[model samples]
Target: MSDQKTGGFIATAITSIAHFLTEARKQPALSEEAGYGASPNLPKPKPTLIPIMKIAPAVGWPEGKKPTPAKGFAVEAFASKLDHPRWVYELPNGDILVAESNGPARPPANWSFRWWAQDFVMARAGAGRPSADRITLLRDADGDGIAEIKLPFLENLHSPFGMALVGDQLYVANADALVRFPYVDGTTRIDAAPVKVCDLPSGRNHHWTKSLVANKDGSKLYVGVGSNSNVAEYGMEEEVNRAAILEIDRVTGVSRLFAGGLRNPVGVDWNPVSGELWTTVNERDEIGDDLVPDYMTSVKDGAFYGWPYCYFGQIVDERVRPPRPDLVAKSIKPDYALGSHTASLGLCFADDGRLHERFRGGVFIGQHGSWNRNPPSGYRVIFIPFTDGKPSGPPEEVLGDFRSTEGKALGRPVGVIIDKKGGLLVVDDVGDIVWRMRAV
Candidate 1:
């Protein structure tokens, strides 16, 4: 049979097997409580021949519907009818920039049954859309907590995820490069051509979305580059300069690795109190549901956290060949765990105290949920309180009910940001809405 025939046969076989095997694996033995804070103990690995497939199918929210906010908070649709708004950036003037893009298509190199299955999951999760390649500006204009005017701020770009502004320059992190354009105060649109800052990893981008951040003085830019494969299954050579955070000099565009061994670092931020860089990392899969917990950590310069060879600091993976025990020995453990396969992607620190006291000084994370776990987790936005620059307590849900009682997804939270007025903004790609959360 031809390749298409083989692929079809395998896809059908896997689908048939998944129904029977969904209940074969055990539920989380320990409560998710055991998976947070600075010292998360690694659970014993339970490798599986087939991953548990329990995905919540994406279903658009009905009219006048929105996510349920935590007590003392209310949610309103800040803006609606967007084209896959995956990331949100608030300008100094309080204008919100929404990145309307998706994963760019690449060359069909490594087509297999697993690849097809992965694609299916993405489709059901509402991520298999073509890139819009534009950034939209939403303005409330009257401090009403709802955008009254919407404008296309920038257009004709690659798959963009992160945005940063320094002085007169507005930088946009596309899938394959970092580029910037001149920005004028109070201007709604940018027409100037973008100057390339540096080229990023592309093509077979297993982790395509590159999250960008800048230092306090805007002297350097930090780009989070995820690994090309789950555990370097495609060979170690393909991972050169990948799976690391590249620090770039803002003036000259020269880049160097700041940290490595992160499987997929999706969210990047600077802790306001400690003035340290932190990120949310998505760990490897197929090693059972609760084995390797997705975590957040303070990124140190010239540090390795162990991707293919080890995980969570010196826990051997045993799957890698020619394993260098030296590198594993140097891997630093993460600061806090966000649970296994939660797909924790968005991170932002809260310093403003205009909101409720409970959420005044904390870090809000957007967990996009997961399909690999049998009893699905993380279809919500959570808050991790911080005191004196460190996580002080376990995570608490800030927004929930994105997934319906019937196991259908009304939306999945992705990139999160704080509006200039101190309200929290969440990007729900599946529902194509930007939710504004604030004290009621």
Candidate 2:
């Protein structure tokens, strides 16, 4: 799977074409600050012939070098050298489960320019590694902020991403379905087979990562399913139950659509202050540098945020044939824009006094960084303050330098969570490390 030499020549040629296209493109109409906040500046449309393809090849971190931690905090590697670690879940007993996974091989329906370009880009961005298909358990028995033991907790998963423990059953959101297994507190391994809860959308599987979360009472489950193709290019029939959030009953496994038109809501959590569900969504691309911005919003039940037709609420995308003006009229504007093409994929709000008091009432997000925009954005961890369940202050960079000085991706932060010891843990999928940051 790590075969760079195979498409090296074609990829090199494509890079040259990309540079020309970027230069021909107009500069961003909105300023950097306009790309964020609740009322972000949405620029005019200037769709490109092909998606803007640019990337900093993923190169493992150099020995002894790591990300720069925010002031008043110290950072350390919780676990290192993992194979494509993508997401994390902390058990009630303080055990951390990291999903070591990569997308399963999926060829395009018919090979074309877009397909080849995406394939080359994904491989160079540290996705060339095959899925490890297992969740490893890390334990900090001594509480030194470093995991003392790293063991295979569960094996043979199908690209598992989100995990949660509710009572005696552990729910794992594999790409294809929701499954459960028997669990014992403080155990290191599970040999028991999983019971399928329900199937998830996976055909074509353009966006295969299915993020999962449970309710406060643990009586219900929410799974975020992404669109199978960009803008429903493959056909709307393939997009059934996609680009929407599915709510499932833990008892009967019956699922229903919670919200729709989110594009790709990779993370979901409940707002402790407002008692509302929220999600971070990745917006549609290939439009322009500032036309669409990825955002986070309070997910209202039976709501449609508008995908493949509109973005940032009421702004219609003309590319979609057979216009849906009715849907555009009802599109809900997001609560906050995370910057265009920032690829904001992970979200977790601070509910308790877990971390430092300065960061007590805010949300920690992991922006996986962007390849669709030049001068790449969001390769770090950021904290946005909130009050009364709404964002109140500007964002602060919590961790940075995810890419090397030579324009190589040293890491790409994916999932962010608060550990049992009141510390922040970030999953760096590209660097293959889980970084822990605690107050000094």
Candidate 3:
């Protein structure tokens, strides 16, 4: 049986590669910039029978090999040789928390083209590692940028991602639920039991990352829950409370939907100047790479941004059925577009942090890089300048060189945060290093 299974897998692989190559030839390798800004140049929709799959093969950074910093800037390893770190958080007392985690295993499914590709292709992109299931603490005791002390602060978590501290309690957004533990300032370790806050969508969990943020006074927590399947292909019945941000009361643990129609809202932050909630969303794939550009938008109460039914302001997606015209009419357009298939994930406002004057009064984004577009986009950190709470111009590259000309990734940056000293910190999951950036 084992021999037969292996043979079948190899056969399928050969056939899929042939198909992928043929399809790649048919599609035009257009510039990703065609899908940027308020009025994007969205060409005619070109839905494919099978999605294009392109990912840079993950290769760890060579010794002394780091990303290229922007002009007048420098990059250094804040902490190296970590497990799969995905998210970062800072405490009141200047302690840093890194969620060293990866996706949990799913059960084996029946043989299919898309299923096979997802299993094998994602792994090639350095996403096949087992979950670390713990949060590590790093303290810069001597006020230097490098963290001299590193230790596990919380353990045995079920694929934790987002975290926020409210008063004396620290909340963690796990894959399946939101939980909290008691935290004290200047504490290096947390051995207490976690209190359950509320449940988050988890079954089959195609997009399981649950990012979180807290409002002023710590009265409510906003959680980002991604869709179970792209474009509701798995049926809307399975999508209850998914693809939306949920607002939970910190004291009562009660939850409600704050906004909807976001396919995969990952990073949520409040704009310091506007005091408005904002998020970076990952749009649906398999349509043309130029369609459905991922976006960053301010969250409005009871507002819907189109998901499976429509995109980019009522440009309907014909893939879905039953045609809810009413919903399409109500779909709100996003504020800014961040290139198609870029996989924009992390969003951090330039609040009090002073990395440099160029980064001031702007928002920093970490694009996780693309897997469906040729000449794949977004493997670097970018800054978008804002004038009076609105995006003023195109993104300026802050860090690059994550992808090589030979199609290999040295690192894939994930969550980004600013430290106490105003230095910018980037978490590289593929390289397993936390890098700190400073103005030279």
Tens-place lDDT per residue, model 3, 1-440, is 69669857865775487456646576576785667777787878877766667778899799989999888899999998899889999998888999998877775663455555666667878888899999999988998789999999999999999999999999999999999999889888899988999888888778888999999989999999999877887789989999999999988889998999999999899998999999999998877767678999999988899887899879898889867899999999999999888889989998864776666668989988998776588999989999899999998888889988788989998899888788888999999999998887
Per-residue error at 280 for model 3, in Å?
0.3
Query: lDDT of all the models against the reference?
Result: 0.87, 0.88, 0.87
Q: How far off is residue 374 in model 2, in Å?
A: 1.5
* Candidate 3 global TM-score: 0.96
Deviation in Å, model 1, residue 76 alpha carbon: 0.5
What does candidate 2's lDDT look like per residue over 202-304, in tens digits?
9677788989999989999999999977787877888889999999999899999999999999978889899899999998888877758899999999999
Worst 10 residues of 1 by lDDT: 25-34
Prediction RMSDs, each to the true structure:
1.8, 2.3, 1.9
Candidate 3 residue 323 Cα shift, in angstroms, is 1.5
In candidate 1 the C-alpha lDDT for residue 390 amounts to 92
Residue 349's lDDT within candidate 1 is 85
Candidate 3 residue 103 Cα shift, in angstroms, is 1.3
- Give model 1's TM-score versus the native structure: 0.96
Cα lDDT for residue 101, model 2? 89
